[model samples]
Target: MDRIAILKLNGFLLVTIQVEMHDQLVLRLQDDLTQMLERTRASGVLIDISGLDIVDSFIGRSLAQIAAIARVMNAATVLVGMKPAVAITMVELGMSLAGVRTAVNVDKGMVLLHEAAGLEAR
Candidate 1:
């Protein structure tokens, strides 16, 4: 499938973007994530982007939007595993990605997610 998979894990949702997302995929992710959040009532979200080597302005903005929506739905979002080049590109493109917290790896991302959800990370 072209869609990304979002796994529910320990009161949080894990979304690992393993593809170069296009517009439709990004939009669908937002919709699907929203439904998942409501259905699962997750406390936090952890999105891994290590597989992504490039990120355009639209994708960056979409990530921020998804995090915002999650926050509104009572779920915090932590983005993880961003490539250095992708981070630089986003800054150069003037994308702040505000409201979305970030971590260096999935392990750290889970810690942040758990912390935000007021759960003790093991």
Candidate 2:
């Protein structure tokens, strides 16, 4: 797995992960994302997953968990850049992402976040 990248901008946090789609990556992401949410006290989180081509059960569950945690932290989480093929595969596998918000791309996700947080996009 590659290093996870995190950036903070305008009270929103962006996380990018470049790694194999696997259980370990999901666990690490959970920990890292949880910490980021708590430490930043962010209004929203944008997760970019354009690099990932596959979405497994473990990864999907981890994402759901992250969204839940963000809510508890008083922040909204938006998943962005999901590939169409990966989306189809996830649906076929009966993996339901409960309590998770998704956008077609990062720009849309940022807009959603801004609306959710009642902030004007700059």
Candidate 3:
């Protein structure tokens, strides 16, 4: 079962991570989200990580990879709701998260995705 709930909303994939994800769970999420995006043909992906208080290099790298994969599939990726500590940790760990767009919150993320897709915001 997917620990992450991947919901499709307005031609985009909404993923919320509200738990402390183990390594295996995170990997599974990567695979599952990839499949879900392909199956749904979403215009973008918005990952909500406000619930997570920590982010390690492995997790940061995985997030970057997911964004890269989405871009290859012609879908935009917007990471949202990252905590301040998480941001500090990622910077300290030298995780640039290239190719991954970020927003302060889900609303802004949706706006970015909508703009990228050339759709009017709802």
Candidate 4:
């Protein structure tokens, strides 16, 4: 029952998925993330998936669901550290990850969030 921890930083929620996850873990993450968003009142979410070697359809849809939920909560979602192969595979698998924003790395992700939230450049 290892769950992904959501860290709140400078008005944003940061989650780094370090291992391949099962369906239950993914569902729990989505629930926890939305709850965190509401409790913390964070303006954005930065998801770092650099350690993940693959992005299966289930995981991709979960990401999109998280992003969608965050959007309705008035929080932006930025997915960073997606490998080229994973991105290609995601597309090939028909997961467009629509409505989800992405960045090259966490630093750029933060910038994207700040810009979207209209915060002063950090």
What CA root-mean-square deviation does each model show from the true structure?
A: 0.8, 1.5, 1.0, 0.7
Output the better candidate (1/3) by lDDT.
1
Error of 1 at 105 (Å): 0.4
lDDT accuracy of residue 5 in candidate 3: 81
lDDT of 4 by residue, 1-122 (tens): 88998999989999999988889999999999989988999999999999899888998999999999999999999999999999999989989877789999999999999998999759
Find the 10 residues in a row with the least total lDDT in model 2: 16-25
lDDT of each: 0.93, 0.85, 0.92, 0.93
Candidate with more favorable, higher TM-score: 3 or 4: 4
The number of clashing residue pairs in each candidate reads: 0, 0, 0, 0
Superior by TM-score: candidate 1 or candidate 3:
1
* Candidate 4 global Cα RMSD: 0.7
lDDT of 1: 0.93
TM-score of each: 0.97, 0.92, 0.96, 0.97
lDDT of 3 by residue, 3-122 (tens): 788999889999999997778888998999999988999989999999899888888999999999999998999999999999999999989989888999999999999988999988
lDDT of 3 at 86: 94
lDDT of 1 by residue, 1-122 (tens): 47899999888999999888999999999999999999999999999999999999999999999999999999999999999999999999999878889999999999998889888998
Looking at model 4, the pairs that clash are none
